[model samples]
Target: MHRNLWSGFCLSSLLAVFSTLSGCIDSRGIIPQALRFDDAKLTTDQTIRKADRTVEWPRDQWWQAYGDPQLNAWVELALAGSPDLAMAAARLRQALALAGVAESEHAPQVKLDASVQRKHWPADRYFYGPGVLGDTTGWNNTTALGMNYDLDLWGRLRSDTERALSLAEVAATEERAAALELQNNVVAAYIQLALHHARLDIAEAELKQREQLLELARERLAIGIGTQLEISEAEAPLPEAHRQIDLIEEEIALTRNQLAALAGKGPGEGARLERPKLSLHGEPALPSNLPLELLGRRPDVVARRWQVAAEARGIEVAKADFYPNVNLVAFLGASSTTGDMLNFLTNGSKLTYGIGPTLSLPVFDGGRRRGKLSEATAAYDLAVEQYNQTLVAALKGVSDQLIRLHSLHEQEIFVGHGLETAERRYQLAEEAYRRGLTDYRSVLEAQSQLFDQQFLEQQIHAAHLTAQADLWVELGGGALTDDSGPAAEQLDAHKTTLHLPGRH
Candidate 1:
């Protein structure tokens, strides 16, 4: 018999069971072997160099390299308390449970049944007990063993088992994704808080310089040398700085509150983060030289690809109809009739098993069954498309991050020079003001320049770090840390997490 002939027969049966998803799939649409984005073509690859040395992150939790104890403690606390992580754990168990279910289906189901009964008869009633009607009525006991099995019958059960296993893998990937996202959010929030604090300090220092200038200007005005407008202008910087500082305080409070919730702690109850520090592993390396092919290794992409295959199997399972199916069912368990277990063991002899063959062949079903098969077919196609799209999106994110990282690192370098210049000017302005050659206005202007430059530095540094974090994610570490379960597995030799579906 032709393989396609049998496949069609099985599919016809599926049409009866599953509802047809009309128009969900393109009937004539050629599902391109879902194209992976050409990453090499997209990226302008270059090595990033730091003044100190060459650095490569090597998939380790590079964030720890910064040596900030406070940052470490906060991450630990948040990991333990995060409800989202807990939820992801629960999902992992669920997937594992489903795998168990599929595995169990491959084994025979065993059952034991027992019962007891008491009956009273009228004084003149005729009653058939086990003693009277050959064990039809009770005080009576009966026992037997039974079992049943569904033969593979065109590999439907096997496909089902594979589908379940794939689903479990997808769940594991989702867990990893969740962990990565949770940690990223925590780090980002901490950076934001640190940035705000640094800004506030800058503002305050600027304010103090302005206050000194205001006092000097007012004194000069009293002696008719400084204008009233000059004193008023000198006073303005202090309030502005104070207001900026107050705003930063509000942001810090908000960030702390968010961290508290994420860490599963009350506000101000856990490890406090000091000023943020940047620990970047030199420049990030693109995953493998072949960027497009490497995307298959990404957990998110692989997980969804598994779904596509599983859906294909589901369609096959539904199609199990076109061929004749033979089932082998038998029972080999002790069954007892009578409330007393003792009587059944003593009175009934133990018996072993029986087997029977049940066959099913599709005759006709008004195209209903065929419709279901088509529906599954369409679903598989849809799944494949979605998987491809996710891969593209993942590649795009990586490319975008690399571009940003390159530019931001350069921007920071330039900004560093600007800051140095501002510092030098501030130093010169102080001497001039003391010598009474320059007005207090020059002192205030120099202070403002220094403060602004410093503010830009903090922001640029944080932006650069964040860009790296995102790049790591896009490259498929997706938050794989040295100690993490899947992350550890992916890097080290134990259970391999490398299931790239489309990659050669």
Candidate 2:
């Protein structure tokens, strides 16, 4: 008994030594090199200094701030019906299922196996001994229950589960990003429709003015005070003005179709849409902690950050692969080749059972383990770089939108003043022409100037509205917040160089 006890101790010590030596693959050089971006370090103080920083972040339904009920309804419809969003949602569900699969790996597994057969042995004198039972048929049956449970001494299963969960988070954020994009598209199309309506109004007004000018020219000619040149010039502008009206009306119809498509409906549905009365009370404002908060606000950035986290977990899984894997395996069953069909279960001699621990050590595999580790580390670095790139692009998008909004605001002021002066000049020119104090050319030139300024004013106004929409989109469309899943900073906090068991 003492010798047996010593033999068991020696076996355990040998196993321990073998396990320690099995992890000899050089994993010290396989480490990720890419670094996560620090949101606080990305300076944006001077860029948005003039922006109103007192307003809160945009709400979930940010489009409602435009104060247009029709816009609100359309946005809601798009959210419910958009196929792009549906696809994104499906991807998220698939990711969640995969995560569940990974988690299941950490749990113990049990299986039942059973088989039954009737066998016949031929009575050949040379193949069987004299006393052997031959030329007989018997029932052969077996039934067993087996179980396996991993010890998880290396945390391989845990890291794999974590990676899958992080990928699920990435999918969730992508879904949010898709939803936000749909909303932006719907609003953008509606804004274009509104601008088209405004332009149509201007075109119709110009056509009316041209008709009145032509009538005035005819009256002057009948009173022997105007030349044929005046009538010809007035008629020429009338045709062009009508054509402008037609073009604007066509644009309006096309824009309506675009809005319907964005809502995942037919063109006819969009045709029923009334002119949008979109308006905002004040200029869009930024938050005081724009740069620092943007990491959590932008869905794309959040998704990328989650991807990095998943890859980091992948590195852990790979590192765990270099260690030994231990599993507890057990089975209980009965088998019989004689007696009744149920003899296997009733006879004590047929009983069979086993329970033991199994160990799998990676001795050598032609550098397969090292290759996997290198691959994992490379994947982690790639994800980190992608996250960093996304963050940079997000910041640039915000700054670009803000700059456009500011420029549009300043241009709107100038265009308003120019429009007022043009309207006054056109009125004076018409009055002088009717009194025979100026020629028809002066009236035509003044009308041209007034129309150009009117178009310019409308253009600036439309730009301001579109730029505001873009800013909201660049600001993440309010799809993320404190209540959202893990933030980029939180994910980055877990980022570190992975080391093997004994590597310094």
Candidate 3:
């Protein structure tokens, strides 16, 4: 009896000491409560205006830069039709909802539960006094309410909440990236269709000119002045131009179908785009050595950066599992093991309650927790590497686009001059042949040359339009304006996303 008493006393003292030490650990979790991305400072670029080219972007409507109302309408329809945009919007909401869940965890957990039970005993059972009564068949009734909570002795909860918020920000950034990409696709399709129509028109015009030359050659052959070879040569270019038209038509149809899918309607939904009278202007000058400070403006980069932060917080969560966890459980109830339920509730109803913290120490787990922490840490490192890779890729795209724009513009200029000279040469050749200064063969050669020139011009024109679109995509498209978001916050302290850190 003495040994048992001493052991119990020693245990009580040990508990008292441990309780004082446990005060250092708290269910309040991390200090200051919230981990905010506001602390992440972004570097600014002072050289944004040094780009040497100062041209205004088509602000109200990017498609207007092409000076085509039809293109504007088609692009708008595609933006409205994109199912991917809708999906992206929905996902953003989902992530925000998950963030709300994490935020809720920061508050005290509260719960309520109610239940009832009935029990029966055999008449043979007897206890206490009144042997005859105890031997009677009987039933028992009980009702109860319960509540339970876990005390956050480690920073696990706080880390989890921060991770959730980061994920939400990542979702929002992804949505923006998806929207931008969709817009670029719509515009690209519209421009391509317009370019094909332009080329087809030029091809048909050349084909008509060839038909006129062929008629003249046949007349000469009938008069015995021209050979069958001359007539055949003049007719050759006609089929080539028609063949070009067929290829262009095929491309136009396919592009229209692509636009249709983008608009979220039947494959033929978007407004038909007319080929704009595009003034073959020299290449659009892109901004050079853009401020690295605005690198976060790219949604893809920002999203990736947030992912890195989420992984970092995950590491902390794994580390937390290495510590002890404290849970508090409690209940209140009334019960009576009596034959009469009403009588049992009359002053004899049992009432009870329980409140205490449970400490779950990390003793032996076969290294599972350690493995998880290592995995989380590795994932964080990978995310960082990916962020750097994205940054480099974005810069490379901009650089390459700039070079192509210049080269394409120069090529178009020379091709335009060549087409004009060839047209004049064909007109002179026809006049000379009619007056007998040249033979049917000279007119035939000139006509073919003109046909070649027109076809070359068509290709060069398309190349110009393609290069322009490339520039838009590189500058991240849309009206060139304030490229940075002051209102958009970094979502994670260790990473950055576009919602002002704590606003979402």
* Off by more than 4 A, model 2: 52-56, 118-139, 338-349, 480-504
TM-score of every candidate relative to the true structure: 0.74, 0.89, 0.76
Best by lDDT: 2
Q: Per-residue error at 45 for model 2, in Å?
A: 4.7
Which candidate tops TM-score?
2
Residue by residue across 127-161, what tens digits does model 2's lDDT show? 85454457778787899999999989989999999
Every candidate's CA RMSD:
10.8, 10.4, 9.9
Question: Which residue pairs come into collision in candidate 3?
Answer: 81-263, 81-264, 489-499, 489-500
For model 1, residues 1-504, the per-residue Cα lDDT tens digits are 699999998878765543233222222422224443444565433431120122233355544544456666777777788888899889889988987888787777666665545444333334543343343444544455556577776887788888888888888888777766766777778767666776777666666667877787887788777788878788776766788888888887878888788787887763354555545434444333345543555678878878887887877676665455667777553444444545656636355567776666655566665677777777777788787678667866766786787788688779879988998998899778765678777877887788778888878877876776677667665333322222111222111011111110
Between 2 and 3, whose lDDT is larger? 2
Task: Give the count of colliding residue pairs in each prediction.
Answer: 23, 0, 4
Q: Taking the tens digit of each residue's C-alpha lDDT, what string does model 3 give over 1-504?
A: 999999999979967766566455332322222232321232222322322253433233454566556666766775676799889989989998988897787665656543334544445533435454445555466655665576666788889989999999899888877877876777667656756676666667667767877887888888878789878778777777788889988888788778888777775453354444443222233333343533445677788889988988988888788776877866776766664646445677777777776676665566677677777877787777777777766666656665665566577678768877887898899899876688777777887787677657656656666666665555556534645322232221111111110110
